[model samples]
Target: MALAVCVLFDARTERRIRELWARLESRGVHTLATHTHGRHHPHLSYAVLREWDLEAVHQAVDRLPDGGPFTLTCQGTLAFPRGRAALAPSLTAELARRQESVVAAVRATGADLHRNYAEGAWVPHVSLATRAPGALLPVVVAAVADVLPMPLVVNRAALVDSGTGETVVLPRIP
Candidate 1:
């Protein structure tokens, strides 16, 4: 099972993203919307652990900074070669620094990290659809294009189990 350190958005932002997901789902486009035990939340993952000891990870990250409801500007849609499309957020220096800290803290626990999340390799995004059909790309793009440069408030952080969609640890982000 994979564990992810994710920054969750506020209710308003969550609703906006869910609305987009609904639009995609209506078109039969597969997305995280129905994945992860059907409990997926709109979030920007900072790091993903391939292996981890739950308690150890919690202790390691508990001491890290959990500041404001930072604003993330979603520039536009970005697609992966594997048929996944996501909202690309402009990475601010502060977001990068926080992500680095999370990676460091998780690594300190001796957990195996996903290479894609390694310091310089991470790409911050809020996934919109996966396994999307080529025929549906234009539809998906058109649905979200008007929402470009969307602003979202990330006010919480959590350690989520990718397998069960359970929140393993939710540290209070001040």
Candidate 2:
């Protein structure tokens, strides 16, 4: 439904998150692993754009300085309206700056930024369950708690289309 500039986790980190997803899925909780499209990657987004020019947005982001890879510690789970649940990561100054830079670059391309991703409103998180009902909160919480304070290794970046699950891999983490 939107295009997101996201930082993807390394294989190790991805596997760990996937394991949690599997556990939740087995318990009848709908996680990203089997969410709509069923082709989601384990990632944390810098920004989600309601509209954008793919190539222009890509070029703009590519022009920015590389922030390189970094690690994020997810200490707890965050539940949002409409049954969305995610791992809330501790924000580092570098991560904030990188996100700001990406937002600016994409906005420069005339992309409409999703309000949730606006500068002052952003909340950095790696999504887990896409539609976890209130009845499944305990399951989601317990699954996440089992992996609390997880060290997430971010090694790549990309522009992913939420509707089609298509990705345009970025040259660097910006």
| Cα-based lDDT for every prediction | 0.86, 0.93
**Winning candidate number (lDDT):** 2
Task: Determine which window of 10 residues in candidate 2 has minimal summed lDDT.
Answer: 140-149
Listed in order, each prediction's TM-score against the native is 0.94, 0.98
Best by TM-score: 2
Error at 120, model 1, angstroms: 1.0
What digit string (tens of lDDT, one per residue) describes model 1 on residues 40-138?
888889899999999998888888866757898988887876778999999889888989988999999999999999989999999999788788888
Error of 1 at 98 (Å): 0.5
**Over 4 Å off, model 1:** none
Worst 10 residues of 1 by lDDT: 165-174
Per-candidate clashes come to 0, 1
Give the residue spans of candidate 2 off by over 4 A.
none
TM-score result, candidate 1: 0.94
Q: How many residue pairs of model 1 clash at the backbone?
A: 0
